[model samples]
Target chain A: MKYDCDACGPELGAYLLGESSDETRREVDAHLAACTACRDELERERALRTALGDLPTATCPGAVTARILAVVDAEYAATRRRNRRLRGVGLAGGLLAATLAAVLFLRPGAALRGASAEHYTPEQVATARHELIQTLTLTARVLDQAGRSTLVDVFNDQLPSAVEGSLRPLDDPTRGG
Target chain B: MTNETFHELLATHRDRVFTQALFSLRERRDAEDVTQEAFLRLWRQGDHLPADRVAPWLAHVTRNLCIDQTRRRSAARRHLGVADADAVDGLVAAAGGPDDPFAGLDLDDRQRRLLDALQTLPAETRTVMLMHYGDGTKLADIADAMGKSLAAVKVQVHRARQRLRLVLGTADGVSEQRGSA
Candidate 1:
């Protein structure tokens, strides 16, 4: 709709603010071309807007930037540390899960005393038992060095003498070697 | 965002945010506080906020915070029964330094008159004017932040313009009459 001066009077604000729709702007432009009063009002609005825009901007103080950066860096570092700790825990959990699977699948009667034993050749059973015993021996030595002997005691009762000899150093507190 | 990108954002947009808050609040300390708070908010959001939109986002947030601060201040003034003149004094005290809007302006008589007249506008009206004229924020954005209709924000700006014009025009006409006499 082509807004005349009367209709465009209130709409002048929206037009000057660039908030008016294209149709309304076109109408206002057409009206402004003919209406001196409206043109003068528009001029004043433009002048005021220009002056306000030209007003000097306030600068952010150096101190504030320093302060904000410090806080942001600290928070970012904390997030990184937490993520690293989570990754460590995930690695440890995966290793523990692998150890549990080895123990459950290769126990003395678990694979050798049933119809399941026929599925394996004699050579395969011998290799599997040998690897399982080696893994348990390494685990016992690690626990002994760490001074956590509760699980080591259980391993000592079940392991063969060949594996048990390697664990004797872990029981001697004065033996650094 | 990485620290490098955030530092760039701070350098590019801090003045814009500070200017908006300063003009809207008319108090240097409050404006500084608002600017710091807005940037702190930016830091909290971190890489989640897109880089290109940072300027307008900061402007919008700073304006809203200034408006809220203004409302709280006005409420306190009302509860304390502070008069208009005293509020002006409080403004000076709150300013406390070289945060004058007219600073470094080579203003003519009419421009000076307009600036003086601006100081007389009500807080909400002046805020609309500042956001629209000073900060160059869109009226639709101002309307959204002020929680007013677009029409209402426009009307407020228009009225502010008319008020400044009346004050400045009358002064000009009187001076011309004296000159002619």
Candidate 2:
């Protein structure tokens, strides 16, 4: 191994640390035998590594860790509160949606009577129609205010179509208004 | 991640993270700040991080935060027209606090020289040296954690060792001998 100091300098650290490959270690070993400078350099590196290992560990202050945990605890609490609020809102929305569905679908003479408009006078039909519209408007507003757009969408698109389908026979010209 | 798991991670890694930050930034306050920020980030992203990779992930984050703080300090120094000499003096002064790991320690002359030289190296090189030697982290693990190749990590550690030797006067005779040869 004709390794000069310049050529062997880089390998010495790895060689000292035993990070060098077996073949590289042999080459460095052979080089060190012939190279006094390289051996001294290796010794210096060994000393540095030993000093580094001796360097005291710096522990985080108890107060600092406490402060960090305090922040994390506060954050976790706030998140839990937020999740609770959202769950409450979701439950309220679900109940409101179910109530609306029952009012629209389950009331007698509401959806079961195919010709509901024909069964009542013009005034009765107008009053019933106004009430249905008011109920839908209120439900939509509540869902919208709750920031539950999916429920609002159900009210806006599907619920209206359902009401219209139930009253579809009312659109017949042969049936009096 | 559960709160209990996060707390366990903090308990396990806080010292290592704090030590790394202290070494890289050379300031207790900045190191604490970086350590807190790193942990906060870990907490926020804990669910997304794999359990096996937490150590490396935390190490990488702590190193990045330290680097960011170092750059900010350099920019502030440049803005204020503070010379590097004054900044070095500030670092020395900062290390005199009660919590300083080196304070009142019975370090030998060579160890003292090496410590001083460690501060002179670049942040990346210093970090590699400290991680490899101080933390007893394997070079291959450091390479994987730092997203660097094994060869690159070895080079950084080698360069740091060489720089420390030069700073400590151990390399002077060797250099002269080689020069004459």
Q: Could you tell me every candidate's TM-score relative to the true structure?
A: 0.64, 0.66
CA lDDT, candidate 2, residue B128: 77
lDDT of 2 by residue, B19-122 (tens): 78876776789988999999999999959987767777777888788889988987877876767757766877788834554544466655656667778987
Runs of candidate 1 with Cα error greater than 4 angstroms are: A5-20, A90-177, B71-116, B120-125, B141-152, B166-169, B172-181
TM-score of 2: 0.66
**Poorest lDDT segment (10 consecutive residues) of candidate 2 chain B:** B172-181
Worst 10 residues of 2 chain A by lDDT: A168-177
**Model 2 Cα RMSD, 1 decimal:** 9.1
**Candidate 1 lDDT by residue in tens digits, A77-175:** 876666655554444345446765866664555546564745877865885576566566555544443232233333344233434554455456642
Candidate with maximal DockQ: 1
